[model samples]
Target: MAKDYSLMEDSNRSSNRSIHDISDPSRRIVLRGGLGMAIGRLLAPVAAGSAGCASGARGDGPLLGFSSVPVSTADKVVVPEGYIAQVIAAWGEPVGLYGETPAFKFDGSNSAAEQEAQMGMHHDGMHFYAQDGSRSGLLVMNHEYADDGLLHADGMKTWTAEKVRKSQAAHGVSVIEVEQQGDDGWQVVRPSPWARRITACTPMSFGGPAAGHALLRTAADPAGRRPLGTLSNCGSGITPWGTYLTCEENFSSYFNGPEKPSPHERRWGLRKGGAGCRWHEFDERFDATRHPNEPNRFGWIVEIDPFDPGSTPVKRTALGRATHEGATVAVTRDGRAVVYMGEDARFEYIYKFVSREKIKPRGLRENAQLLDHGTLYVARFDADGRGRWIALGHGQGPLTAENGFADQGEVLVKTRQASDLLGATKMDRPEWIAVGPDGWVYCTLTNNSNRGTQGEGVDAANPRRNNTTGHILRWKEEGDVDGTRFRWTHFVLAGDPANERVEAQGNIKGDAFGCPDGLWADGRGVLWVQTDMSPSAMGKGDLTRLGNNAMLAADPHTGEIRRFLVGPVGCEVTGATGTPDGRTLFVNIQHPGERPSGRSDPEQPGRYSNWPDARAGGRPRSATVVIRKADGGPIGT
Candidate 1:
C-alpha cells in the first residue's frame, strides 16, 4: 500500500471491566534500583545548570524586554511595568464579520444560533497568520471546554435543550481577522470572509490509515471517515503549510451511555455517567453504546485552514490518537516535516511523525497532504541520558498480527498498545511541546499525582516518586532534527527553591513555579512557560506562595527563569502567540473562579475567579488578552 499515514497499533489494551481505570496489570514494566539511580545521576546536573541545553545559540538583540512581573492574586492581569493588556475577545462575543451576529449580552443570554457566530469559551492555543505583512492577520484559537454554571442563565440544575445546544456551540476553534490600529491598539476585523467559527458541531473528516477503520465507523457515518466536530481542544499549533492544528484532549469525557464497559470503551472513559456535561441526556449520539464509534471519531488531530472559512477541517490520523495535547512541527534539513506530540496522560509516551515525502513549499494543495503519510515513532529515554525513537510501523519489530495489529491502520488506531509493545518510555503527563530556534525540542511534563502511589517507578526522566510539581524536558537530536537517536535533559524542575519539593529533589533553580503546562518558544528562542496548578495543590504552602497560574520566561542559554505575567485568581495561563514582528502578544486566561481544590463546592460554587470584569459583578468568562509594550519592543526579547 502507498501509505500517507504512519502505521502500527498497540495490543496492550486494558480489560473492558477496568478500561476507565488504567491500572492494567498485564502491561506494567518496572525499572528498579540501580537503573533508576543511574538515570537520576545522568540528569542530576540539569537543575545545577550543567548540561544538554545549547549554550552558545542565544539570539541577537536584547534577551529580555522588561523586568520580571511580580506575582499577584488580584482579579486582573498583571504585566511587566511598561506593558499593557486589553481584552480583545471573550466568550459570547460576536467575532465574525460584523452584522452577522448581534452584540454579545454580558449575561448568559445568547441563543445557540447567536453563539455559533460568536467567540467560543475557554480560549486557548492561538496563532496569528499574517495577511498584509503583519498589519492584519487571522487569529485562530482553541476553546478547550465549557463550564455549565457560568455558561447558562440557569445553572446545570436546570439545563434545557437550548442551554445544551448553546454549550456545544461554544466548544471548538474560532477564526477571526484582526488588525493593528493606530500604534498599539488591536481589534477584530469584522465583515471579513476569514472570520468564522468551528465548533463541536462543525463537520470534519478523518484521513490517513485509520480513516475508514472499523473502530471509526458510526451510524451517522458508515464510511467511518466523517466525524462531527472537535472537542476539548487544548494546546494547538500553526502548521508550516498555513493550517491550524487544533488538538482534541480529554474527548473521552463527552460520551455517556453504557452500563457494562468494553476494554476499548473503558480506555477512552466511556462510562454510565458523563463528565458532568450530561449531553447524552439531550443527544442520543453522545451515548457511546447507542453510537459506539462516535467517541473514536474524535481524539484525532484536526487541521483547519483559517484563510478559507469554507474548508472542511481534516482529522489527520497519521498521528496516533490519545489525549492529544498538541502537535508542534519542526522541518528537517531536507524539507521533510517532523511533528512532535504529547499524549497528555501519566505513564503515556511521547510521539513524533516524520513525513515520507519532502514538503514542496510552492503548492498549498500538495503541502496540505504532507501529514497524510509518515513514520510514527515513540520515545524511549535511556539511563545514559540518551534516547531512541522506536518505530510504530507495521511489519517493524514487534508490530505484527501476533501483537494485535492487523495492518498499519490498526497500529494507528491502537497507538498506546503499539508503544507498550515497543517498550517506549512512559513520561509524566507530557503536555505541550515546542521546538526552539536552536533546533532543540522542549516538552512540559505536567504533574502526575500517581507517580509513586501506582504505576511506573521513578527514573531520571521522572525522578520524583510523586511528581506533584512537574518539570520541563528538552532534547537535542543526535545528528539532525530527523535523527533517530537523541540526548535529553531537564530544563526546569519546577518548585520554589525555598520549599522541600525543591530541597528533596535538588533539581530546580532558585526561581520556580509548579505544574508547568503551556510551553512556547518565541522567535528569539526565549522559552515561555505557563502554569496550570490543580486546586488541591493550591491555597497553601508553597503553592499558595506561588500564587495564581502565571507565565515565566526562561533564558535557554543560562537556564534562568523569571515570571513575566500573572493572571487573575484561579485562571490557567495558557496559549501564547505573537505577531511575526513579535510586537503584540496574545494569551488565553481560562476558567477563572475555578475552585482551588479542583472540586466544586456547592456552598461557595462559582466564587473562584472574577476576571476580565472584577470591578463589576459579572459571570467570569474565559477570554483572550492582547499584550503590547509601550515602546513597541519585541515581546520577551
Candidate 2:
C-alpha cells in the first residue's frame, strides 16, 4: 500500500539493538511575532539566534560549549568538566509485586509472566516533573522497546503464554518516586501510589477514528473500544493539564500481517517487504486473517493520567494513526491544543493534530477533552525551509477523494491512507519531538536517502542525501493549530566532527553530529541535542565519532551545539530528563555493547549491559544514568 510516515517515525524498532545502534541507530519550529527572546536568554557570542536553551553557563563548573572533553571511544559517556554520571535504574530492577525484578537472565526463554515486575529494556524518550524541586519525586519514562532475548530470560522466541503476559507487562512504562540524599545520591521511593506500570497488558481505551469500529475488534477486545496492551511506547510529552502522554512507535510490528490481506483486512506498507508473521508462532492474535482489526488498535497516541493512576488511558483518534514516534503539545492562537508528530521512515511524512477544545490549564476538566476533537494535518516542507500543514479533515484535502471514507470517523480510521492520498512531503526518518515553551516546534529529521543525484532530491528541509547526518527543524504554526498554514526553518544541521569536510563547501569544522533524536525543552528553552552513533560515524576518527551517542546542549538562537554527555558502546542516549531546579539530569543508556550476538545460536552470548548496578563487571543493563554537577550546583552548565 502507498504510505506516508512523516508525522512521527515508529523508527528504531525491530529486534532493536540491531536498529538501536547509536552508531546508526535511528531515529522544530517556532512561530511568533516575538523577537526571539527564547534564544536571547543567553550571552551566546558564537551562537546568536539561540533563544531556545537552558543557559548552559554556571558559576564555575564545566565550561559552556563543546570545546572540552574527557576521552575518545564509542564505549564511554563523555561530558564537559565538572560533571559525573550515575546509573539510576536498569533492566531487571524490580518495580512490582514479585520484587527484585523477578528471577532473570538474558535469555529469550523467559515467560511473559516474568517480564512484569522487572524494568523494560532499551529505555528511551522520557520526561521529569520535579515533585519536590529541592530533592525528589517521580521519574516517568518509556521503555521505547525491547530486543529479542536481549531483554528477556530467553527472548522474543521463547515467549510462552505466561512469558507473553510478562512481556506485555514489561512493554509499557515505568514510574518511580525518588529522593536525593546529598551531593551524589538517589534512591527509589519504595512504591508510592503514583507508582504503577502501564504495560501492554494494562487496560487502555480508544477515542479516535478507529474506536468502536468493527475492524478493531478482537477476541480480547470484541467491543473495539479497548485494547489489552500498548507496545512500542516510545518518546512522549507531558500535557499542560499534567497528564502523561505516551506515543506508540513502531506498533505495527507487534501484529501479524499476511503476505496479502483480504479485501476487508488492512494492508499497510509492509506488504512490499513480504514474508511476515513472527507473532504467529505464539498466539492467534498475531494472525491477521483471524484478527484483521488487531493492528489498528495500535499506532495511535496514548494518554495516561499520572496523578490518577487508575484512570483508563485514552488514545486520541483525532491524531490519525501511523507509526507514531512522539508528540509535542502547543496552544493554538485561540488556545486549542496543537500536537506535532513525525512518522520516522525513509521518504515518510510529518503531521499535526489540533484539538477541538483548548487546554485551559492544570487541573481543568476541559483540558482533558482538548485532544478529543480537532483536525489532523500532514506536512509538506519546501526547499526554501517553508512548510504548510495539509488539512486531512472531512471533505478537505485527501479525505475528499471517493474511497471508503463516508464520514469523519472513516477519515480518521484510515488516517494514514488519507495522508497518502494527499501529497505530503516525505521526509527523513523523523523522531523524538519537543515544543519550546515559546511557541516553536522542533523535530529531528534523522536521515534519508538523498538519492544524491539519483532519485530522492535533497529538499531544503531535508538537505542531505542518505542523510546519515541529520538536522533539526523548527516551525511556527499559521495563526494557530487550525490555521491550515505554517512557516519553517532549519534550526540546526548535524554534521561530523570539526575537521570534517562537508559534501560541498567549507570544511564543516564543527560539532554537527549525525542523526538527531531524543529531544526535550527545559523551562529556560535550552535545546538538548542527542546523537545516534552510527558504526561508520563512530569509527570516523574525529569527524563524527561521538564515542557513542552523545547528548549536546545547543543554542538554537545561535545554532551552537555543545556535547553534554556520551553513552557507552553499542548504546544510544535515548532518553534524558531533568529537575526544574536543573540540578540533576537523568539519561537512559540503552543496549550498550550488547556483546554482538550472533543470529545463528541466538542465546549463546552471556554478556549484557548491566548499568546503574555499577556492579556489573562489564555487562551493561539498558539503564538510566543520572548526571549532576560535582559541587551540587544546577546541572545545565
| Candidate whose TM-score is highest | 1
- Write candidate 2's Cα lDDT for 600-622 as tens digits: 12453334333434343223567
Model 1 residue 301 distance off true place after TM-score fit, in angstroms: 0.6
Q: Candidate 1: list runs displaced more than 4 Å.
A: 1-62, 458-463, 501-506, 597-606, 615-617
Candidate 1, residue 391: the lDDT equals 90
- C-alpha lDDT values of all predictions: 0.72, 0.60
Q: What value does the lDDT take at residue 433 in candidate 2? A: 70
Candidate 1, overall lDDT? 0.72
Per-residue alpha-carbon lDDT of candidate 1 for residues 1-637, written as tens digits (9 for 90 to 100): 0000011112223321111122221221111110000111211222001111211234465465568777687878999888879888888778875578666765567788888989898888888777776578888999988776666665566757787788899899999988889854888877778888888888888888899998888888898988888888988976656678889987767788488878667655566765657787787788887888788777888889888888999999998887789788766666677788997766677898888888675645878888989898988876556778999999899899997888998888778877877877777778898775444578888776666565446443334666677777777787766789987666666776656654224244435588889987765567788988765566565565688889988766656678898888778899988776667888899887775433233344347766776644466778888988888777775
Best by lDDT: 1
